[model samples]
Target: MQIFGITSQELFGQLLLGLINGSFYAVLSLGLAVIFGLLNIINFSHGALYMLGAFLALLGLNHLGMNYWVALLVAPAVVGVLGVLVERLMLRHLYKLDHLYGLLLTFGLALVAEGSMRYFFGISGETYPVPEALQGGADLGFMFMPLYRGWVVVASLTVCFGTWYLIERTPLGATLRAATERPQLVQALGINVPVLVTATYAVGVALAGFAGVLAAPVVQVNPLMGSNLIIVVFAVVVIGGMGSILGSIVTGIALGIVEGLTKVIYPEASGVVIFVIMIVVLLVRPAGLFGKQA
Candidate 1:
């Protein structure tokens, strides 16, 4: 019944939870990787955008009477549009400037977004109810799994890989890659690199938004939600090697499982486990597991 000082049930449950956490980690880091690869900007506002996505879903549910399913689609679209605007109005100008400028500007925007939300919402979390359709759990041999959480894992994996395939296997993705590698050549070939840049940013933020919506039912929707998770995601991005789509996905899930195991074995270390792994990765391979050294 017990495995390594913990029950099988407990282990399975924690592992399931870890997978769910990893789902979010993978999506968020994937977005970060994508944006960094193309735009060469570290998007500090990504967390804010994620927070906004959750709030947008909440708004849709509370004000517009939209269901969770609808919010899943609508929330990302709204936030994606916001991302495009941010790129056009703010980020685009900073592209030619130092990377530090992008970081600072986005960080400032994050502060403003969080501050505004706190002013209105008072930093209290708003609950988004799990949809009626997904309000149950499945009884596995070892443990019971929440339907929504299981859905999160499946949905996250599907989206993560689908994005990977699109970017890695398709012509659009090929064009996007070419644009980043050789913008002048892409432009000469009449690919409209600027438009592609904007669209890539939009897609990246949309991924963040999608993750947020998936998370809202599982966690309280709050201004600080994105802030809390972004750090871990960044670590995942670093450990997996930034801009490596598959690397991000695999590392995120693996770290999540490791975090879960730590919680079971040593609860106190759970909080810092991912960062600890990150430090170790930094020391061992400065370029990360899948990263190439410049």
Candidate 2:
């Protein structure tokens, strides 16, 4: 059957691909939202950290004979620890300075991280093999769905909603939110706000790291991997609202589907469609679709 001059298969295929891409966007943007909402810092190094996570997985697999499952857990933990160090040794010092300072520092850090990886690994990309269990596809009547892609969507959604619930539903989340709005009050209440801030940053970047591992098999594991997607991910966060968890999740998936459909309808316009939507959203709702008015 044909609809709008496109075969049903082609349409569904693009939708599936878009959903896979959207999964990554949702996870990455959720991390960005968490950091910005809590730390009030623009972590330009997020992409670099994501790259590092994939690299760690690659290294672990090659050097230590680790499997995909091991790397899935280890890579994120390692990156989260590194995040803790960065938060304590560097980011904390600049908390009182302008937000621009944090941005510049992180941007520089991203460059250094990417450059170092490029130096060691070279610009050419490497591929991480899919886990044996997820190597096949399933016939879903409308389309053949790759098991790994389905897993990506499921995993990303779980993490996104889990994080959202943690922040928006739980007492710990309540404290975290309270700390952002009234750090002094939260601190006076006997909470170690600095430690909490550091932990929050670690968790945020760890999400990036987790996404990296998920993506290692889907895309080339190159130093520039994170750099390539960071801008779009940032756009996702902005459109979702700067610090709105639900906003990020919804916008990421919606834009991903929009981009996918555009590729089918007009290949040339697909690349710019999200940015165009972003511009329109900015003009209509300067705070973003879900962002609060300042």
Candidate 3:
């Protein structure tokens, strides 16, 4: 039962946890890649939107007497609408300006959201109870797998692949890509490029919201939650290449597993390992593992 100096059960457990983290990373990065690749905008507020999603879920449970199922359905729609408003009111004006303007605007938005939440909810996190349905563990020979965690992995991957297929393999995805690369031409062809852009941004942020709902039961639903993970997600985006959707998914999962292994072998390095990997990737292939050369 020993693998290296660790028990197989322990090793597998770490790997499973890593995979769960990777699932979140993959989904979040996928959303980032979609926004940046198509909209040419850096969504610094994505993490905040994610926080909002979890909070919204909490609000539903506390005030609305909604269950987890209802929160899962309502939270993303609410956040996605908020994203549309942000796009229409603010992001649209900045598209003609430098990308930095978009970054600054979203970064400021992130700050405002975090600050507001901190003021209202304080720095401490609100606990979200796992649904009765997913509240137990299953033995998997090597290790006992938490049902919620397994659900997270499966749900995340399903969403990731579904998004990828939508963007990479569908006609609507083709239209969106065309709009991104040749907006004037797409517009001339009678497609509403502006509307498409707004929709894309909404979809991107909605993804963050979806991830937040998935994560609410696992982690403390604090305002700083998204801020803390966004940096790592950005690193994942860089490592996977912003241009490649598949790259982001694969890289995120791989790094998560690597981080998990690091936790077992060298606990101190767990925190910094992803960043170090990012550094190495940049030095070797500046475009990223899946990014094309500029």
Model 1, 41-111: lDDT tens digits are: 89888898889989999989889999998988998998889888998898989887998999899899999
Q: Which parts of model 1 have CA positions greater than 4 angstroms off?
A: none
Off by over 4 Å in 3: none
Q: TM-score of the candidate numbered 3?
A: 0.98
Query: What's the TM for model 1?
Result: 0.98
Predictions in order: lDDT: 0.91, 0.93, 0.93
Per-residue C-alpha lDDT of model 3 across residues 1-294, encoded as one tens digit per residue: 787689999999999999999999998998899899888888899899999999999989999899998898899999989999999999999887898999999999999999999999999988999999999999999899999999999999999999999999999999999998999999999999989998999899998999999999999999999999999999999999975889989998999999999999998999999999999999999999999988
lDDT against true structure, model 1? 0.91
RMSD each, Å = 0.9, 0.8, 0.9
- Model 3 scores what on Cα lDDT? 0.93
- Candidate with more favorable, higher lDDT: 1 or 3: 3
